[model samples]
Target: MDFMIAAAIAALLNIGLLGTIIVIYVQNTRLVQSYFTYGLITVASAFMVQNIVIVIFWFNLYTAGPAIKTIVDAAAPYLFVINLAQTVGLAVMVWINT
Candidate 1:
């Protein structure tokens, strides 16, 4: 349960970070009209969608009752780490862009 909460938080953080990247990329794309900027926007958009899905999945698991929770517990730490890593990576990207 704790791990799930952590994972969810990390996922949410990732979504926020990705949103920042996407906005920056969109602004740059508008100013520069470069293919690389367009690609960055596309990739960031895709990552945002992925983080959204991860959050949704966490919510579903939270409401799934005890049976599924045991399974989720086993996987929660991995999910948390994965999401945290993504958040860190995205944060760095945002930092570099800014």
Candidate 2:
């Protein structure tokens, strides 16, 4: 159950990050070249969303009793895996960009 929940959360997180970029691009008024200008902002926005969510969940667990945190605890492992994947993905993107 925990694994499943984590998987779902991770999946949602991945979709959400990508969706942010896509939505920004779609709504952008400038030419494609403007993407270069937005590049840093886009990456910052994505990272901010990811970290803010992790911090919120981590804080929730820390502040809540175990009984209340039981469900979220189960999802921790999956979140860990996804977090590692996301970190690696960001690393790769940075490498490629540089």
lDDT per model, in order?
A: 0.90, 0.60
| lDDT per residue as tens, model 2, 17-85 | 555544554455254557664875567566757666775766667458868677677767767687658
- What does candidate 1's lDDT look like per residue over 11-91, in tens digits? 889888989999999889879998899999999999999989988987898789999988989999999999888988999
The worst-scoring run of ten residues by lDDT in candidate 1 lies at 54-63
Question: Would you list the clashing residue pairs of candidate 1?
Answer: none
Indicate which candidate wins on lDDT. Answer: 1
Clash count of each predicted structure: 0, 0
TM-score of each: 0.94, 0.54
**Candidate 2: how large is its RMSD?**
8.0
User: What local lDDT score does residue 8 receive in model 2, on the 0 to 100 scale?
Assistant: 45
